[model samples]
Target: MSQHPAVTFRSAAVVLALALGAATPAAADAAPRSRPGDAVRSALDELAGGGEFAGALAAVREPGGRGRDYTAGVGDLATRAKVPVNGQVRIASTTKTFTAAVVLQLAGEGKVELDAPVERYLPRLVRGNGHDGRLITVRQLLQHTSGLPDHSKAIPGTFFDNRHRYFEPRELVDLALTQQPLFPPGKGWSYSNTGYVLLGLLVQKVTGRPIGAEITDRIITPLGLGDTYWPNPGEQRIRGAHPRAYKSRTGEPGGEPVDVSEMDPSRGWAAGQLVSTPRDVNRFLGALLGGRLLKPAMLEQMKRTVPVPGAPRGWGYGLGLTKISLSCGGLAWGHSGDVGGYSTRGGVTEGGRSATVTATEKSLTAEGDKRLDRFLDTALCAGQRPAAGQALR
Candidate 1:
C-alpha cells in the first residue's frame, strides 16, 4: 500500500492544511476599499474584453484584517442580471474541500484510517490496467496518488451530453474505474476526479449514509453555515440575491450564453457538489483550521502530504486537504476546485484569515488557468504583510 505521511498527488495534497488557523471576524473597518476587489475585477475585465470569461465575483480579506467585495460584468448574457458579491454559482471542484473535511472528521472518530488500503472498504473498486485496489490507500485517493485516470470516459459525453441530469455516485465511480491506471500506486502524482469518487463511496460504505448527509452533519450544521448548501435539481438558485452564471462555447467559436441554472449537481457529487458564498467559505475555512474540526494529532497526520515536481508545489493530503502558500507571509490550507462551468479557490491563512474566489467560466485551457492563478494570487496576497523581502505580487 502507499505509505502514510507521504503525499505524492496534486489534488489530495493534505500537508497544505498546516497553513490555516483561527477565523478572524469580518474586519472592523468601515466599508472596505475596492482595491482588492478591483485586482480580481480587473483580471475578469481583461478576460471578458478578450472574450474569455463572461464574468466573476471575488471576495478577498487582509491578513491585518480588512475585506473587500467586487462584482464585475453580468451573470447572464441575455437577462443582464448583474453579478452579485454573494452569487450562488456552482463551486464545482471546490466541493472537494468539504468532502475532505468530512473524511477527516470520520478519521478523527476512528471510523476511517488515513493509510488504510482502499480495498479494505470498497473491495469492488477495481484499478484498471495491472493495478489492484489493495495497492491504493485512502490517503492516496485524497492526494490524487491513486494512479487512477480522471473521469475522461465519463466526461465530454456523459456530463456534457446529459448536463441537466443527476448522476449517482456509483455510476461515476464505475465509469472512472473502467480507465487504465496512470502509474503504479504512489510512484507519481496526477489529478484524478476518480479518486475523489471512490472517496465518496468510502464515505457511504463506512457511514451507511449519503455523502450529502455526512457533510451536513459533520461540517455544515456544526459550523452553522446556513447559506452553504448542496441543492437538488428542484432547488438550484441561491436562496436570496446571487450572481447569475453565464456560459459560452468560447471566443473564436462563440456561442450564445446559457443560463446554467438547470445544470446537473450529481455529476460532481461529493467531489464538487457545493454551492457557497465567500462569507460562508471563509467562515468554514476559519473554523476548520482553527482547531475546531479535528484533533491536533489527526490534523497533523492529515497534513503530512506535500507537492512535488510535475505537480504544483506546497500540496499535501491528510484526508481531502490541500496546502497552498501565500508567497507573501503565511501559508493557507484548503482545496482548489473546478468543474466544466466553474472554478474556485478558498483557504484560510495560518491565522484563520481566509478568502474565497469563484468564476463561472471554464478557463480550462492551460493558458487561461494560469491567468486565473495570477488573478487569485494578486487578490489573495494583496492585503497580507509581506514576509521578509517577499513582494506582494
Candidate 2:
C-alpha cells in the first residue's frame, strides 16, 4: 500500500462538523435570549447539545469593528472542560483563501501573472493523468478549474490510521498524477487539493522561500493574526489552548466522539493545513474584503466569480474565496473548512460584519450544517442595519 495515503478534506467545504442527515432536537439554552448577541449564544448551545458535536465556537465582529466570542459544550470530554472562546481549530481548506490571497498579492506586485501558464514556474511538474503544465494557467489552479482529480479522495484507512504520517508537497502532487484528469483545464469547475498543491509549489519557486513563510510574512504577520500559523514539518499538536477535537469511535460518522485532536497535517499542506481561531479568521476576511491584502485591481479580479456546481443556490466562488448569498439579502464572502475532528463555517459581509462557527468533530450531520448556516446568516444580518440583517447577534 502507498505510505501516508490521502486523508479526506472537502477542498470546497466538508458537507461541516456534522454530516448531512436528519436534524435531531438539541437542548435549549438557559441563558436569556433577549440580550445583545443572544441569538448566537442559543445557536451554539443547540449545536453542542443536539447537533451531536462535542463543542462549538463562534466569533462575531460588527461593521464598526466590535467583536464578541461565544462557546458551548465541553472542551475535553474526559475532564468535562469548558470550551475556550475563540479557541484554535484546524481551519482546513479555508487555508486556500490565504494561499490565494498571497498569490493575488504577488500578482499585484507583477511577480506572478494570473493568466500565465503553470509551466512558467513549475515546468513539467503537473504532466500526467491527461493534464499538461504547459496548457494550464496559474489562474486555473487558484480557481480550481484545472480538471485535476483530488488526491484526498484516495486516502486509505480511517483518519486515526495515518495520524502520524508525513507527506511532502511533491508526494501529494504525485498521487494526483496517478489519476485521470476530470476534464480539460478551464473547461469546468472542480475542487482539487492537487491544484492548490501546485500553486503552493509555484509560490515557493517564485519567492525562494517556503510557502508558509510567504503566508506568514505577507499575510499573517502584517494583519496581526496571532492565532494563525502553519505547522512546521512533522508537527502535530495544536500550539495553544484548544478544545479536543473528536472523531466517531468507529472511525465513521454517527458514532461516539473520540479524541482525535492531534495528528500530522502534512497531507493538507497548502490546501488545508493551517490552524487558527474564529476571531483571527474573521479579521483576515474583513481585512481582505476591505482591500488591505490586495491592490484594488487584483482584489476586483479575485471577486470576479464563476458558478460553483453543486453548491447552494446563488453560491459562487472567487479565486480562493466563496461568495454566499445571505437570506437577509446582499452577499457575505468568506470560506468554510473541515478537517477530521474539527469543522469551521462562517463568512464576512461586504459592510465588514463577520462570524465564524466551529464544531469539534469531523462529522456534522446534514441538519447540523444547515443550522450553522442559519446561525451564521442570523449573525451577519441580525443587527448590521446596512443590509436586511441587524448588526451582529
Candidate 3:
C-alpha cells in the first residue's frame, strides 16, 4: 500500500509473473522468433494489442552496437497518433537508482559514509513516532531497509486532485514520520519513498545544492543523457514530443481511464520524479552496469542485495537497482517505475545488452503487468529462449 503508484503495480501478482514460467503467448500468432529484435517487438505488440495501454515503446542496445527502437499502439488515443519511439516519459522510482548513484559517488569521494547513521548528516530531521535517525544508516535508506513508511501511502487523493500541490522534501518526510516505522532499521525489507526523500535532503545538506543538480552534474551530464531531466517545481508538461499518459479511474478492473500526462511532479521529488526517454534510460542502465557510473568497489557494494519478502522469486533489492534471474538464463539489472500516466521497466545484462520499455498507462492490470515482463524477458534473453518446463531461477 505504498503511496507511490509504482508500488501498487509491484504487488505480488507482478512479482510472481516475473519469477515463474516463460512468456505466455499473447495470441495464437505469438510465436518464437530468430531475428534479434523480433521477439522483443512481438512482446510489445502483444501488450499494446491486449488493450491495457494506449501505446508502448521499447529501446534496445546490443553489445557493441547502435541499438534498435520499437513502438506499438497510439501515442494519443484520441487522435490515434503513433507513439514516439524516443519520447520522454516520467521515469518514476527508477530515479532511485540515480539518487543512489550520486550518494555512492559521494561515499567514494570521502564526502559521505555508507554505513554512518542518518543522524550523522541530518540530525533531528528524522525523529518522530517510533522513528529514529541514529539507528538507520545511509545504506539502509538506499536499500529500502530503513523501515520508514512511504509518505505517499500515508496521504490519500487522486492525481488530478493533488496535481498542483507542492510538497517540500521535509514536508513529505514529516508525513511519514507521523506514522510508526514499518520495522526496526535493517531488520526487514520494505520499499519506502520517504527514505529516499531523506537521502535527497542529505545530499542537499552535504552539497549545498539540490539533489537534482548533483545528479545532473555527476551522472546525467557525464553520461550525455540529453533527453533526461528533473522537472522544476510547477512544471507539469513534458518537453519534446511524447506519448500522452493515462491512469485507471479507480485503479480497479475496468476502471475508467483519464489523461494524467500533464500534472505537477513536485510531489514525486527525488523518490520518483525523473522524466526520460527509452533511449536515455537504456543508455543510463548500460553506462551504470558497464562500470561508467561508479567505481568498481562502490558498484559491487551497490549490487550486494537483500531478499525482497513480497517480490518474485530470484529477484532481490540492491541499493537502487533490482536484480532478476531470467528464466531464459542470465541476470538482468535495472529498475521499474510508475507515476500517474506512465509505467516503465528496463534492464541491462552483464553482456552490455540493455533495453527499456514504457507504456502510456500508469496502473496496469495483473495480466498487463505480466505482458510487460514478458516483453522485458524477451528483450533481455534474446536468442536464448527458455526450454519448455525449464526451471526459472
Task: List candidate 1 segments past 4 Å from native.
Answer: 1-50, 61-67, 127-131, 156-159, 233-240, 250-256, 311-318, 362-364, 385-393
lDDT: which candidate is best? Answer: 3
Could you estimate the TM-score for every candidate? 0.82, 0.89, 0.90
Between candidates 1 and 3, name the one with more favorable lDDT: 3
Those runs of model 2 whose alpha carbons end farther than 4 Å from true positions after fitting are 1-37, 251-253, 384-393
Q: Provide the lowest-lDDT 10-residue window in model 1.
A: 1-10
Ranking by lDDT: 3, 2, 1
Q: Write the per-residue lDDT of candidate 3 for residues 46-138, one digit (tens) a residue.
A: 777877888887777776746777777889977888887578889887888899899998898999999999999998888979888999999
TM-score sort, best first = 3, 2, 1
Better of 1 and 3 by TM-score: 3
Output candidate 1 Cα RMSD: 5.4
Give me candidate 2's TM-score against the actual structure.
Answer: 0.89
Whole-structure CA lDDT of model 1: 0.62
For residues 105-185, what per-residue lDDT tens digits would candidate 1 score against the true structure?
888889999889999999856655566888899888887787887764445554346767667777777777666777898
lDDT of prediction 2: 0.74
